[model samples]
Target: MSWKDEIEQLRKRQALAKGMGGPEKLKRQREAGRLNVRERLDLLLDSGSFREVGSITGRAEYDDAGNLIDFTPANCLFGRGKIEGRTIAVVADDFTVRGGAADAAIIEKQIQAEKMAGELRLPLIRLIEGTGGGGSVKSILDMGATYIPFNPGWDQVVANLERVPVVSLLLGPVAGLGAARAVSSHYSVMVKGSSQMFIAGPPVVAGIGEQVTKEELGGADLQLAAGAVDDAYASEADAMAAAKWFLSYLPNSIHDLPERRETTESPGRRDPALGDIVPRDKRYAYDMHQILRSVTDEGSLFEMGRNFGQSVITAFARLDGWPVAVLASNPKVYGGGWTAEAAQKITRFVDLAETFRLPVVHLVDVPGFVIGTRAERAGTLRHGARALSAIYQASVPWCTIVIRKAFGVAGAAMMDHTRFRYRYAWPSGDWGSLPLEGGVEAAFKAALAGADDPDAMKDDLNRQMKSFSSPFKTAERFWAEEIINPAETREKLTEFANLAAPLREPRTKAPRYRP
Candidate 1:
């Protein structure tokens, strides 16, 4: 045969090999309500944007005479792509090749992708399903008795989490290491019904204990409630859309400032409701989110840890097209009291914001840390102390705005230090060691007992204490820098942000954090 004819025949064989599972598996994947790996990458990245890296790599097989098998595209697809016009490293596990299990070349490809992301400072997104690049039983003979060391990919995965925003989407039955990757991400999502994640499959677990389905063990509902995954969606398409939406608020890399969307409203434009959002009555509770929404550019608040810590609300908000981290207390939940869990959440969030060098805007309304026997058993003290330590140690530009009820050490910890930056107070700000209700009961017991009308006397004492507990009263003593009108909040915060813009400090790359 002519050499040209031989080359043509070889190309045909290569094409045939590349079509490994062919149309049948693609149809089956569609029937299962899951997007195939390639489809997932297409949906996640910009159209016509992906530059595939290892498109023609796969299993090494042999014929009956020991001749090599034709080359096949690796069951894994990875390459560079753009999300919202920003470059990112994309890795999608193809379920067609032994469910995308760890093979030598595939492992190397993933490692290379991760390393590139780290070196280039681009964000990484993993579309993981099945066993997530882990070993298969067949591998026992492939390497003899010598075990393959646990993939350094996990370390790189964790390291990327600290340096940049890492996102994962669970589109199918994610088992073993796949579940770990989903949970370790900065943000993770799973498609309901179609997606499930577990440490081990039902058959393996059934050998040791009671039988349970994958969903029962680690369904979307299970992970969302456990805080292992951030959100759950109805479809794989929805999950991809959610991932895109999430990355929009974050920067392309930790070193870069977060991009902003244009708005007609000026940064200094104040929402009139802010003026009276904090009630004059110290005991009254108001929604802090309302105040946050009013002060920030309309539709600019992207809340994080919304479900985990109900007391403290942490969000990325835009003011005059600049990104700032806003931390405020929700008095509606736990009476705006910090619990051990809430403290831990705050500490982690503060560390994240500080690491990214985002300016912090604290809207203080905390009464204090949650108290009582239940709190002590939960190690509230240790966690609260750690939260305080994180806040104090943060070198980022911080501005504290005391809206109302900053009391005790928790309250004090909310204030920006002299070196850190500005501290402002609304006209409604009132801070002390503790609220007077508890103090009145403890200190005025004898006075109330000696009164003719005990109930009326107690009521009178409460009235007297409430009368003096005004933030305006505290402001008279210069306890706060200035008590401003609520309408002045946006202007004040914008001024602070302008001052802080130049105070940003560069951060050195570090390994990912376990938290």
Candidate 2:
């Protein structure tokens, strides 16, 4: 064909693809307040910066007369884009095409995208919705007699997860494989009323004896509470905004450290409330989050697992422009006690920060593990041990600030004095193998039993033990490195972060991280 004739044919094809679903569907989507896959890409990426791949790929289907029904790109969209000036790889599913079903070519597209992100060391963001590339009954006919039971691309996906930051956004109904993709991310977000995620849809679930609405079973509230998703938003725009905010703190690749922005805020800036956030009495409880908010850079704390593991707080925050992961005990819940659930949450979080080479700041206020029949039944020992293992395996710089009671195995697990790079205790901090109250009862049982006034004698013994159990006593013994004023915490942490920044040690011969 002549060059002029070819150009006219190409334009006609492009026009037809652009009008695939016609105007009614476009108008309905506009009225419903949800952005389509292409629109979402535009909103997420820098203006005119997205370079699309596989735009002309689609289903290979035939009519009764054997005529082909060619369409635009396949349901999946893969591209390279810039978010807030930082380059990233994006894979978005077009729900308009066969509900974004899994096909051989589309699966190859996803695998290639993941491989590109890993090999190039770029962070990947998946705009997941619909079926999420799961197997369909129609696959039986497509594969004929010789078929592989499992997709090979899953391995690449898993490999990319450990190498770079993976973010997934649930913009619509995510089922089966789709839900897995969402949770497999280092971070995930869901739009409140619009998104629902589940292993199986309501139709499949109904056959198993229970009939429930999608939202009731796998709603944003349910997933957030279960720690399956990191955050939920009221709208798609909010979800995209959050994704941008999250990527701002992470590096584009493992070869580079996260970039820091210049800030007018000083590292020594302190909130007055830190001085008295914790009460002097051991029995009193206070919100550790309040203390964290006061000490870290103002308006910089981005919390993770907020609903699950309520006793502990894990978040990313900036101290004068440097990113650090803050792990604090929330005394408001269970008196800052650690449970099996809390232990699992902490382990996962610490591993993530270590993978990304982020420094850790521990705000210690642990009393002990939650002890009861329920705790024992829940395999608390095994889970708590996992948390300890993760902390021990961490290679990144760690610093702990003992805010209050740091007692028993839980305290030791928070930040081991022997292994941690830097450790500081506040004046009000207290540390022991066990709290003095329980120890006094166990050690002075005989003495109190023989006394004329057992109650009075027990009270006296408790007071005596409390006096020697103060944080200053530990400082005197050189168990705690130094005791600092509450106001100096931000400055001290920032100095330590700078000191630790230059201390980089790569894993030379270590085995792959498990769990």
Candidate 3:
């Protein structure tokens, strides 16, 4: 009465599952410069840490006498895994199996993965490839029926956004549901040359008179430029490494605050370069990235959305080893003006910080919302309003450093003035409703027009305005809490991190707006 026979059969089924659509399909997958699902999981997680769910839940056939004959394992591979010894939930599409189409997928595995990630409060990593469980004509023929479409476990997916960190990697051609899943993540990446994302593949698009290749339609660079995904990498391994690095900065879920790490860098260490990074001339754009890296712990800044939303830089960095959200204006792009894309990026980034209980440090150098017919058509002001709302709604500890120009509505958004203003200004801070350069003529139109030499009068008015616009004037009025030397930025920011660490409380946040 031993269960040895059944145990052997179970092992046999598990072995079949491991085969993963057999060697031929796997060979093709490798030839396409992609790793199989199992290989991806191995690379993504700590060695030998994957504990697979539904190992044998797939199409099976048996003899009339009830003896097993053949089995085809499900396309969806999901389980609990470890990244840097920390547990995470992973759901990867086995593209070798029917190209990971709906017919070959075991939907229960995906649903359970999402559910477990939320219920157990673990970060969810989706290695998306193929169509992301989207149906095909073959499925209808196999089932002998057509049905109205609906996502099976979408509630869990949406809930996980607030409950846990969701990272998706687009590793291959992804269409329909796959594309949606990648964009839904808190962070997403694509392998540069291999990955493509679209509403539908080229074959389907050709029917609509748009004959385009997959790469032409939705290449990594294209999607990154469109703000569809956070970043891209030259290789799948690099992308996976990036995902691990991103998770290292945050906790398993919103129910836990980000843990601090040990760093050799001194909190009071001052980089002299910070003092000269911002040129006195407003027309010149200094390297914001250099400033960001100098202010944070060595090699700790993990930037996202680099290609799209060029005017704003969003990243996760550590100050004295404390995880913090870093937002800065990229003066190199439109003089740090807020474009529609930049505003949208800010809104999403602020929501992420609020959801995860990450303290925010803003490096302000904004001019204003971009103006012109192109900006107007893009609804720049509307998106900027949403970004402002996100910033105001965030309850996290916030610190703002006015490095240079901070004018107009965009500048005012550097921090919520109504809150306890934990803010500072540099010697070069030039803030107001409008800058004096182009604004003098518009503001003092009659005064300049009545002058004997309008241009000279305008220059004289600018000089007077510049004197009033000095950061000293703002500091004297207590409009800005303090004006500190640029070299002291690291000390002040490290102090802010220490202050914010105690205030970070672990709890679920309101639903994040994903735009």
Candidate 4:
């Protein structure tokens, strides 16, 4: 009598929303080895932490009596959630609802999700599937008209990057708007066999006279190689876990500083094997990964974009439990020379770190920007200049460890000399405008040509250059910072973290993040 009938009607609608495209479609979704949107949310967020918004906003049908008859929930579902006990906003596309086509999308719900995250200063995670807000021809026929294409909530999506962290997961065949949203994040991940992202799926591509399968067109492997997404995993659960781990290194928003975790690992822990990690032969490649792991907290290294840039390594790791961005050169690839891809990767990673106010730690081993025909064609110099600009413009606490080879303009970029030079060098440091092997020919070309014994003359000139190449000579002249034993690397970096902690500040608004 006291409006009890209306309350019951609301409950009926809520129940209908939960049904989500009914039994058969859900069964097919499971058969395809994918979890429903709700299930994916549960896996991504902490247990009992989700508070769904707009649960009952969808299409409704009624009889002549105005009694409720049926309801179909909107495809865009979003709400507040927690990951590792930290609050975040999550938006997911329910593919079961009209294949997540535009006809089934609730535009307001998409807008609110991004707005809520930015206004509340919380991270946003998107679980993208199906077409998301992509248009469908059937919807046009239903309306008897068509309109200009526009993304309703795109401004909010772009603005959120400047305020908070945004992560996206591509969990199924994504096209059009879905694909755009997938890469429009600070970090993105895809499930290997379960996900594919493209501008348009195969059926549409065939209309353009090109036939391609989903995997071949935009598979995880191809996207990773193309640097469109940060990483990929074998399963949805793994991808969700990765998203959680990635947020652990950053703060809730750019207005706040990164959080530090308490750890029992000794800051002064030294690994004697580091002394010999680099081989005496300059041509030989050593395991940089091992050195990275050895110097940070026992198990806090999380690498991103591993497949895209083979010459450079970018990762987030902890030094004495304080989060820092780690950049290193891979001696195994192009002798750690920065290629165009590596240069681009550097710009992206450095921007990310600068946006979050994380301190920078660089392990130097670059010979220069990669040279020759391919490098020139790739515009390596332009990209390399952008990377150098990022390094100099960054205001974060900076530290550099000269591990082995640093040469040419790339070598000089190890640290910004204008700032406080928190720099150290290993006994193995070998840096110059150019390595002696190649420079000897250029510098002594005429001398060698006139020598009675050309080969012997070149060898004698190399020995003279080697005498000056010793790191101790640079240290004596106070040009290079202290040259320490490789075993002392961890202790030195841990000290840097402690020193850098006080210098941390919220990112300035001048340079907003670029996806």
Model 4 TM-score relative to the real fold? 0.98
TM-score, cand. 1 vs. native: 0.88
Residue 370 lDDT, candidate 3, scale 0-100:
92
Model 4 spans > 4 angstroms off = 508-510
Worst 10 residues of 4 by lDDT: 506-515
For all predicted structures, in order, the TM-scores are 0.88, 0.93, 0.98, 0.98
**Candidate models: Cα lDDT each:** 0.78, 0.80, 0.92, 0.91
How does model 3 score by TM-score? Answer: 0.98
lDDT of 4 by residue, 89-165 (tens): 99999999989887998889989999999989999999999886646989888989988788888999899888898
Better of 2 and 3 by lDDT: 3
Q: How well does model 2 score by local distance difference test? A: 0.80
Superposed by TM-score, candidate 2 places the C-alpha of residue 131 at a distance from the truth, in angstroms, of 1.4
Which stretches in model 2 have alpha-carbon errors above 4 Å? 15-33, 60-72, 103-105, 138-148, 505-515
Ranking by TM-score: 3, 4, 2, 1
